[model samples]
Target: MPLIVLCGLPGSGKSRRAEELREALSAESGGERRVFLVAEVAAGEGGGGGRAALRAEAERLLSRRDVVIVDAGNELKSFRYELYCLSKHTGTPHCLLLCPGGAPRPDRPPLEAPDSRNRWDWPLFTAPEDPSEPLPLPEIRAALFERRPPPPNQSTRSQPLQAAGFLHQLDRLTQDMVAALMAAQRNGVGPGQVIPLAVEGLGQEPPGLLLSRAVSLAELSRLRRQFLSYAKMHPGEGEENLPQLGSMFVQYLNSNLL
Candidate 1:
């Protein structure tokens, strides 16, 4: 059974649509497949806790012969991504139902709780005077609900390099390393000069993992070796210097060689 997450701002008919879709799915699939509608508010007091509760509910529903529909205003990208990851982890197909119109639901009363860490504040999603029409069923099925293929070369050996911030720095370092290598090669400078030049290029720490992807294996190995050698020579150097060396090596590869 697949999990469908409906995300939209408040007054966008997410709850109503979820109900309609649930009925449609149940009717289409027959009584053999049940549909569980779980709301975050019923499970917790805070948004994070609510999300965790929703994840747990989805996890439990996965074992049953049913399709789980999460009816909530999941406006944040991070929340949606986490749900996506959850669905993948549970080995269930996932779909996102989005209502772009932002139409107000007259029947659904406003949430009374204050917008704080403890409670959810249903934000107003003011519909445009002439709201754009919803995407066609074919397009929605193809674009929004379609399953994405797993990435190529999914290996456990390269796990540490998957951090986004490290990848970004790795990319920058690859370019710099490549440049230094090229410059050294051109000027007939040996490995001694090339190593220091590469180290000097990779100075700052990367931003954050949420913003980038992993560096390739070839790049990682080259950087790792350079840093290990550097560490051997400068025993008093902080562990933080290791990543800088890695980044420089990657930068060199990206810019000059690959």
Candidate 2:
């Protein structure tokens, strides 16, 4: 299924465009494909912010057999890129549909228009301000069908784990992922920052462990305790099980933390 991120500001009519795109996509796919229009950021299973929730929802939906339309202002270039990386990592074709001429909001970051030169923003479309105007359906379909988006090639910022990937290796026989992640927090990495399992360049920086949102210190502390307790019971011997343990713990955290 394809992923479409609707970009604009508070009053840019992203929701309406999202519905319009959803309907069009369903119709074009003859109702065979389920189209999801996300009007609001979903409440997270664990903890994080609204953006993290949206990312979580998108990741969940993208994993299944459905098309996703994210109806958010997506005001920051960084956020948009995050979605792009997720889609790529998931082997999902994605595009950016921008709604121009949106009313600006002082409370939000200024919108960063999608750049044609950037590969992630390719297959990008702009929704006309007029509600009656038609969306770029054919082009979008072509983009989705033309070819599968290449598998994630590099660890991008929004893709977090390139820098914060110590999670899978978190409980490496010699390394303490929790302590390192906490150290990252101590170094001023806050909510929504890439969560490094270790400090910069210290451990294996794989491409997938990301907290993606804000969790309270109490919550993290509790979660750490839970992981540590579990580790004590079944500490596997040798280095062969490092990945398995790290992966299991990461899954546990993602399941519980968000």
Per-residue CA lDDT of candidate 1, range 4-94, in tens? Answer: 6776656667666767667766786678878888776665624345656776776677632567878876654434544555554454556
Tens digit per residue, CA lDDT, model 2, 1-258: 778988887777788888888787788778778998765545332233566778778878885368998888876554565677677767788889998876886655567678876565777888888988888788888887677766544432243432233333443422455555666767777666666454322337532346656566667667656554434322223345455445445444554554
For each candidate, the alpha-carbon lDDT, in order, equals 0.48, 0.65
- Candidate 2, lDDT over the whole model: 0.65
Q: Estimate each model's TM-score.
A: 0.45, 0.58
Report clashes for each candidate as comma-separated counts.
9, 1
The model with the greatest TM-score is: 2
**In candidate 2, which residue ranges exceed 4 Å CA deviation?**
41-48, 152-258
Candidate number achieving the greatest lDDT relative to the actual structure: 2
Worst 10 residues of 1 by lDDT: 116-125
